[model samples]
Target: MRVSGEKLDDQQIIEKIMRSLSARFDYNVVAIEERNDIFTLTFEGLMSSLCSHEQQMNKRINSTKLEQALQSKASIGGHGG
Candidate 1:
């Protein structure tokens, strides 16, 4: 994932990403790496088979929420600190 903002540094970007993921998923970060302002995060969590329609829909909704949260954060010009 890529995050960029005038007021955010590398650490803040990583923290925001981690917070967003943890807020929606019960997962643990297994590995993380950053280079050239891009972040690669590996996480482990329970495996679920989206065989039911509700399950699939929930997954899509959660993904959309995550994407929106990330985009909103990236667009913020400052932390107001």
Candidate 2:
């Protein structure tokens, strides 16, 4: 993930990014590099998991879409209605 801010300092930006990521995913900061005002953060999933960040993000998106679909169906007299 890349996080950059014009007003916030590097530490502040890192903290905010970490908080946002921790809220949704289980990960550890594997590496951090800064160049040209951009902060590049590399994360590794916990428990020696093999899933990449892109895969995890895709799963979260798909799960959210499924939940929304289920809710819409239920609201319209479908399953669980």
Query: Each model's C-alpha lDDT?
Result: 0.48, 0.52
Evaluated at residue 21, the lDDT of candidate 2 is 61
The TM-score obtained by model 1 is 0.33
The positional error of residue 48 in candidate 1, measured at the CA in angstroms, is 13
Residue pairs clashing in model 1 are none
> lDDT of model 2 at residue 3?
50
Q: What is the lDDT of candidate 2?
A: 0.52
What are the TM-scores, per candidate, against the unseen true structure?
A: 0.33, 0.37
The regions of model 2 sitting more than 4 angstroms off are 1-51, 78-81
Decoy 2 TM-score against native? 0.37
